[model samples]
Target: MPSKRKLVAASAISLAIVAGVAAIYQTFGGESVTSSVAAAAPPAAEVDVAAVISQSITDYQTYSGRIEAINYVQIRPLVSGTIVAVHFRDGATVNKGDLLFTIDPRPYQAEVDRAAAQLASAEARNGYASTDWARAQRLLTDNAIAKRDYDEAQNADREALSAVKAARAALETARINLGYTSVTAPVSGRVSRAELTVGNVVSIGANAPVMTTLVSMSPIYASFDVDEQTYLRFLSHDTKTTVPVRIGLANETGFSRQGVIDSVDNRLDTSSGTIRVRARFDNADGVLVPGLYARVRVGGGAPHQAVLVSDAAIQTDQEKKFVLLVDKENKVQYREVKLGEQHEGLRAISDGLQPGDRIVVNGMQRVRPNDAVKPNLVQMSGDAATTKGSS
Candidate 1:
């Protein structure tokens, strides 16, 4: 009977061991179940990716420059004399030949009168000499007077004729001096401050410095300099095509005038390696002035159809230029591109892009290679009309 009781106890212990093993495995299985639940959750979708496409990408370039007068001239006193009067007010508009100052014309006029009187006297003497010479010829022909007396009269007549010519020359010189007494403007323009006082002596002499200045207000010159690289690059692309220009004062917001290229520098400057280019604008409003610094823009390059993207879209890593190209499937692929030239805010994609190829513009930093994305295609319009796919 004791043996039977022992066997039953052993069987109960064995069943308890089997149940404990099953419980341990069940707890671990619960942990695995929780992990699977978390992993099964869906991920957030990516913002729609849009490809950068083109409309009309304009060809534009930028350069720094200054405003200049088309006709710049200096006002100087023409004659030497004491300044008697200031004809025009300082900083006044002057017409061509407008009197700017008055030299002491009293002295010049007196000299002119004296020369005129001398000329009259010389003319009277000449008339007398001519009559005497004629009489001498008649007397010599008839042998009415001694030959020596006739010869003496002829000599006096010749001297009087020479004196008349000298007097006439003196009168002309005096007239020129008198005209110079009134200093006049060489060109029509705004007169600068008076360089000479009313009482100061001025001329093309020791005090003959510039008395005033005049710069043509109409048809102003916009002078800008381009580096040698640019000149060569632009010239290589376009030859003799006129580039447009615009100018405005610093205080003035909107550009007040428009113009075109008038001339280019004769030679490239070796020291600075820059060439000066000038454009002419009609400043009929008299707003532009000489020496006023301004911004300049020019457009000249290979003529071809091209796709343009915002310069900001271009990303650079090390020495390579690259862009993020979004395919129609909303897949982002990094593309290496060759650049042409930048115009305004857009850059020409010389290679690696085609017309209507969408590109990543904003929010490009969050993207990675081969990352799945949802694309929100943005339309290119307005200034984008200038964007042409690579040619």
Candidate 2:
């Protein structure tokens, strides 16, 4: 047997060797477990994808507008008189030349009769003077009257003729005033309530109060403003080609009314960088009212090939717009895009995208860039039919 000190040293060495072996085993075993876990990965995320559509599209820009009447007339009296009768009901539709009000024809008729009597008296005097002049001419030829007396007779005839002409002119004036007693519609339109009712006195002149208002019922106007860039790009190119326009009411969803650009402002407004444009629309149904809100859409030039996609595919990344695209390696990629006009339910991709490019339309939030995805191919129109594929 060894001594006590030797035994103690031998035991210590044996224990240290066992501890070293245990540490090595634990380290290797832990590494093996970690390696096994790293080899496995979660399943690819499922997402709806669609191929960008290619089609010829005409770009259209929309703007807020207002409906206006083609013809807006304010009814006013031409002569001053007491209103004797109102021919139209309040808010009645009247045709051109339709009688609207009668302003006491009795007074005008009396003046006309007085003028006629005065004209008749003047004509009688003129006849007598003419006969006297004829007699004076005969006396002068026969030398039966003095020269001065014949001259006086001739002068009297001329004066009487002048008086007759003056009387005839007065009669014509009286007849015109009489005709003014009846206030007629100058245009065919819907009229407002009479401002001056029966027994109300109306005055003539520019300062005269409007008796009522009238607005045309058909072929109305829709006015809107177009930005300078849009006007230069679309409207300025073709001076003669009719620019197509469409309008919708406040409650309408789409532009239901078709119209043509009627007139454009001569100069663009520098302050707003826009040009005022007016469109003519047929209001035969009498549904369009003046001063009503309207939505105006102006179509650009000829249709051109364009790439389109559904709005759902577009993602907003802070200030920039992008879409999640799936690559052939079953990984998601980011694509920045410039947007143009919207047609139907599809948005036109102005730049940064091509036709047939697969983009994630649904389940975009579940995936990130370079993420593997199980793409379910669907139409860009959001149809139900789909095909499963790994992307």
Candidate 3:
């Protein structure tokens, strides 16, 4: 009976061992379940991609510039006098020969009258001299008087003629002085506020005070400088074909106004290695003003087939610029690219890229060189149209 009890205890102990082993296996099975879940997950990273564009691109070179008045004039009095009247309101638009100010004309007028009186007296004397000379000639022909007397009368007549000429010159001088008393605009432009008021004394010549200033209203100039290389290229271009330029104001976006290259400086500035260039634009609306900042762009070259990519897709690594391009197998590779002018929203890839290369446009932060990616191809045409419109 004691041996049977011992055998039953041993069987119970064995059953307990089997149960503990099964429980430990169930706990480790959770790890196998996690391994299967990880294996089922996607390996490639998802990224937004766009194809490189191929199109005819017209290149442009941008520059910083300023607006200048085609015609600028400083209005000053031509004669020294008291300002008696102001003909134009302050800051009024003036046309050529428009009266702006009137200096006191009474003094000049009095001088003119004095000259006229002298001229009249001289003319009367000349008439008398002519009669006397004629009488002297007749007397000499008939031998009715001494030769010295005739000679004296001829000499007197010649002296009177000389007096008339001097008087006439004096009269002309007085008339010119009188005309100078009235100040008129020499150009058609918008005038600044008068610097001198009525009752102020104004003077003539270079040391004279400027009464006002004028700047032309229509067809203004936009001046900028181009580098020596660009200047040479411009000179090498066909002379007859005008180069087109565009400009934008400081507050504006893109180059909204158009112009043509009007002139180039005769010599390049050796110190700066640049040449001055001026472009003219229509300003009939009077919106363009002198001394305003302008963003200018000159035509670079003829339109040609070029590869384009979004500026957002470009990546700068150290000193070099690059882009992330995906191959046929959707493996991302780093490509070094040479960039040209940016137009619309797209940048011209002058070198290092070809048409139809897929590039990462968005999600670039999630990508790296040699990364395997699940690329979502997006239509670049729509983006191009939007960019072109803005540009």
Q: Write the per-residue lDDT of candidate 3 for residues 248-339, one digit (tens) a residue.
A: 89997678899888888888899999889999999988899999999998875578999988887888999899999999989999999999
Estimate the TM-score of every prediction. Answer: 0.70, 0.75, 0.76
List, in order, the clash count of every candidate structure. Answer: 22, 1, 0
lDDT of 2 by residue, 1-391 (tens): 4699899999999999999988887978977867788878687999988888899988799999999999899888888999999999998888999999999888889999999999999999999999999999999899999999999999989999998999999999999999999999988888999888999999988789899999998889999999987888877765524777888888876789998888888999899999998989999888988999998999977889999888878989898999999988879999999988877668899998987799998898899999999988777773332455422
When 1 and 3 are scored with TM-score, the better candidate is 3
lDDT of 1: 0.75
Whole-model lDDT per candidate: 0.75, 0.88, 0.87
The segments of candidate 3 whose C-alpha lies over 4 angstroms from its true place after superposition are 1-51, 236-241, 300-302, 324-334, 358-360, 363-391
lDDT, candidate 3, at 118: 97
lDDT of 1 by residue, 1-391 (tens): 9999999999999999999987876968877878899989754235433345454544655677888876777767777889989888887887889888888998889999999999999999999999999999998889898988998899989999999999999999999999988888888888888887889977586656888778888877888888877677663334534655666567753345667778777888899888898888887777777899777766665456777777667789899998877776677789999887654446777788887777766557878656566665554432332223422
Off by over 4 Å in 1: 1-63, 66-71, 145-147, 222-269, 272-281, 295-302, 316-321, 365-391
